[model samples]
Target chain A: MGEFEIFGMPVSLGTMIFQAVIFTALIWILKQKFLSKLVGAMESRRESIDNQLNLAETYKHEAEEELLKQREMTEKATQEAKQIIAKAREEANIIVKAARKEAFTIRTEAYENERRALKGRGAS
Target chain B: MHATRPLVQIFGLTFDLSIIITSTIAALVVLVFAYACTRHITAKKPGKMQNLLEWVIEFVQNIMVNSMGRKDNLFILAGGVGLILYLFIANIMGVPFSFIAGADHATWWKSPTADAHVTMTLAIMMIVYTHFIHIRLHGLKNYFLSFFKPFKALFAINILEQFCTTLTLGLRLFGNIYAGEVMLGILAAAAMKGFQSGIFIGIGSSMLAAIPMMIWQVFCLFIGAIQAYIFVTLFMVYIGQRVNEATT
Candidate 1:
């Protein structure tokens, strides 16, 4: 009546099961009320910190890349502008030289006509 | 003194309420301690109580991680903190207060963990949980087939191993806590005997008996903690074995 024998082992299954059920309730309450909440809060805090660190790192790398790209683009633009300006100045100089040569040719042709006219008059 | 004294009847079920009452008090003590220690926990500027709570939580977490390699889910779901706290508190329950109260004062309140019924229940639960995990993870076929692995000769040994889990775990905790409590009881009896004797001899003898009794109480602290740790360690080990691919 006190304790029963099961498989040659004396045990109070009722008490054992009762205790188990009691502890199960205890763990459930503790988990729901305290342990789970605390652990979750700690995990979230850690995850948030990790996320912020990652965001900061990504932003830093992106900013550095943007700065490098802009510097390269500025250099490229300056080189191209200088080359265009130099080429334009050279073309203007060539135009000025051609105009001077054309004027010289016209002037020489007029002088020849005048000389020829004077020669013809003197000869006549 | 009888440990299983009938306390009260609720409905039709008569019960031995010593373990229940002691366990409830132990549970409440742990609950209050936890609540007080962690109620004002802050992410920044944590107090000593918070630090202690964090340390205990992390310690249990580390045990799980180390034993189960951080992959298994049971390591997370089965909180070792409560088990350790409960067992440890129950193991030391006799240190602060324990008395024999009955019609003849033959019924006693010792450590709840000292009770075989309570320890067996905890052990059975752990083993059941481990077996459930093993079966779920490895599949029922594999779980059963695992007993006969490395040739079919290991079948009986494997069965015994399963039975032994609850037996050993429960008996070990019960034996240790019970022994310690019994020793304290002996010391208390000695002190009482000496204190109750004739005049001059009583005072001197009682003082002498009280000395060892106090010393043993101090020693019981270490024993309680070590027993709790061993219980937790064995539990995690069992879980680890079950979850792993190896049947043994």
Candidate 2:
């Protein structure tokens, strides 16, 4: 015989069909059990990555807020420094004016006293 | 010469040794390269091999999203990758040694896809899986209604479309690859016949003809890969449509 026959059917045909069935079964099992687990792992990995992205986003927002706060603080500090400088200038100006007025008064009193003493000596 | 026998039999099944060896070596090379590429994957910056692999992954992803939409059927992405890898390896099985690899073999296990049994099995799986997805997504009532047309006269046409989709998917791949193998075999036979006459003339002609055939084979390899991709993409689209209809 060319090949074994079963019920006048060639064994090769039966073998091919059997192999196909087995292969199909193998793929089905892989898809059901193994592939499901693989998909679960993939999904978990995706979730982790997404969670990291969210954390990064939160960090970015916090950084932006911190930067804004720093800017506002710097601006406030600069404004305070300007006000203090202006106040100090005003105080220095007041002190200098008072000292100049006192000096003028002292010089005038000394001149008057000297004139008075000269007049008494001349009389003597 | 027995030691250099071309055929090997296992479990009453015969296979061409040259084809088996060549395909195994090719598969090993691809597997090793794929593993090596996987090891170097980094989110920051990717090397050349990593970039190439990522590009392929993204390309397949694009195809999946386009065909299936970016919804619940993302699981099909893995299937698409498997299809592409298997088809690519099987297509390039005949590349080395002047297309004298699995394509030239005349036994089981030669070009795993060239065999009708293998292709039909894949087709059956895809078709059955699609139907299973459909039934699972949409209960039996709506899924069966997909076959019924607006008019009763068109019911047969609608049913025919489903059958044709499965039939064409299997036949198209088989037809393309089988024809390619046949062409390569004919060319190899002609070259051999010419070689028997004289070395100088035979070598010159065969080399001249081989250059174009080699180029064509390369093109065929790409076509084979594309056909495989198209098949799976269509399968995903079918499933996606069913899921969409069910949701709506």
Candidate 3:
């Protein structure tokens, strides 16, 4: 095998240079065409994910607000139920008191009439 | 043999015939598959090949986005495509030759990355590209000064780091693939010698030794692909770091 010399050195500088040029071109093409699109697509995807996350957060907030409203409605219903029950109890108490008073008056009037009739019978 | 030689000659340097043939064939096959998948792609549903191609593309895209932080770097796709094409062919290089399975010369079908010269060239390209990006982002003065620190010792350390990055990038890929080829060769030789020595090894016993080697080879193939990926990814990270620092 015969060695070829270049610049007083027995090195395949030409091959190395050729390879280097090819490599550079490949990288340049890659960077210019492929990477630019990839980065754009990636940025768009990230934005989409962020939008989705924001929407999810808004949904979560809405759900929490609905839950709080429901809780307040339940509390209001419970308080109203307690008030209605209390009012019904008060009305029942008043009705019982009036009936007892009317019953006592009727009994007293009947007793008075009976006593008067007995006195009349004894005199005659 | 003479007729089969000199398939690739540039500037009086000759590369083996089979390497160029096998690499070209593999590249063409991959390109055809990509084209076929793209042609048949649909919005409603994807075929098997389309789905597979999409998975690879999306995987590489995700890695690029995650590593580079969604910079407008279209080069990642080119890097990714080159990586996949190179790595798949490299892994399959030894599969065709049944008779010369374990011989050193059997590697006439060289995985381009398995060769130190090839890997070094790629690594140098990445280094130069990253530096170009750095200079574009920071200008020559800032880029050059970035290698130095206020403290002289730290400046020296920064220089060392740069050197190490290039060295590691080349050596890591070269070491992994070369070791894998060597391992496969050894295993094949052992199996062949065992068969020839009238050992009368049972099929089960033979499989016991062979199965692990086969599994390991598959694992090595995956590792090789990942190493290529890591190299490109690190290159992006280096560029990103420089860009972010300059902007800040």
Candidate 4:
């Protein structure tokens, strides 16, 4: 190792060994302090993003469900309104029919009494 | 014409102080960047530094996944990020300010990766780590058998490939960075010579030198970034070969 020279630069075995050690220490320090934290931060960011997406999905699903429920209620109210209108129409028809029958009976009774009085006056 | 470096001897070993100092500066710069980036990490709203740090991390992860088809190994992911950060910072550290001092013209500051020893050290470390992982993943017997592969005649060739990978990985980075610096130095020297010539020639020649210098500086920055990327990509590729081959 002593007489090794290339391009006027002496290649030192000592320096090589020493630098390897230095590089190892550097890797260890960087792994412990910098890399781990950065990875952790990245992971946490990913987790947060995922959580937010999930929450949004849940909200969307809930909104859809609520919309469905509102539509069903509106449909139910419409059906009820139709049923009420139908029932009122039926009641009105029944009342009109009964009033017409009563009016007819009263007219027949009046006509019968008038005939009976004419016949009795003729007999007298 | 080769530059001289200040040397110190301790315990029968020669240590280059310049390389040590420059490398330490590079390491310190990387550490400071890491610290500042991680000081107040936030998941919801990351600051610029944190964003930068995460970008590098994800970038490295993407490289690994693209190459290795796996990213469950957090240790390797972090290692990749660290390697890139160190190499990039070291490769570009000397670009703006390279200090050659004293009568010896000893380089007080320069890119540590410009030195073969530093790059070789990293390459060796990374290669050794890959082999370790290969062995750990496939046991010693399987790892040894890997050399013989589909054809037993290719044993020697496989063994040679390991050496080649290491050599190329280290040398590629060293060559690019060193050549850039050398060219920059030549331009600077020309500028200095031009400055000493005469009034008009000095200004004219120096201006001529400055254009290339500026252009080379930008080129060096581009090369530094590219070299760092290449080193890490190759590293992941090597590791991927080691790790993925076991399953198949």
> Which tens-of-lDDT digit does each residue in B122-208 have in candidate 3?
677767777888888778998778876556568888888878888788778878876776666666666666677666754444666
Highest-lDDT candidate: 4
Better of 1 and 2 by lDDT: 1
What DockQ results do all the predictions give, each relative to the true complex?
0.17, 0.09, 0.10, 0.42
- Model 1 per-residue lDDT tens digits across residues B49-143: 76776677778888887887762353344458889888898998888657886675644577888888899889989898888888888889988
lDDT of 4: 0.89
For candidate 3 chain B, the 10 contiguous residues with the lowest summed lDDT are B1-10
Kindly give the stretch of ten consecutive residues in candidate 4 chain B with the minimal lDDT sum. Answer: B1-10
Best by TM-score: 4
Candidate 2's C-alpha runs over 4 A off are: A1-69, A79-124, B1-61, B70-77, B97-110, B139-146, B241-248
Q: lDDT values of the candidates?
A: 0.78, 0.63, 0.63, 0.89
lDDT, candidate 3, A17-106, per-residue tens: 444554455445545544444444445666877898999999999999999999999999999999999999999999999999999999
Order of all candidates by TM-score, from best down to worst?
4, 1, 2, 3
Superposed on all Cα atoms, the candidates' RMSDs to the truth, in angstroms, are 11.2, 6.5, 8.0, 6.6
For model 1 chain B, give the 10-residue run with minimal summed lDDT. B70-79
Superposed by TM-score, candidate 2 places the C-alpha of residue B73 at a distance from the truth, in angstroms, of: 4.4
Share of the reference A-B contacts seen in candidate 4: 0.69
Candidate 3 residue A80 C-alpha distance from true site, Å = 33
Residue ranges of candidate 4 with Cα displaced over 4 Å? A1-9, A72-124
TM-score of 2: 0.65
Model 4, B35-107: lDDT tens digits are 9999987889889988998889889989999999977688999899989999999999878967888887888
Sort every candidate by lDDT, greatest first: 4, 1, 3, 2
Candidate scoring better on TM-score of 1 and 4: 4
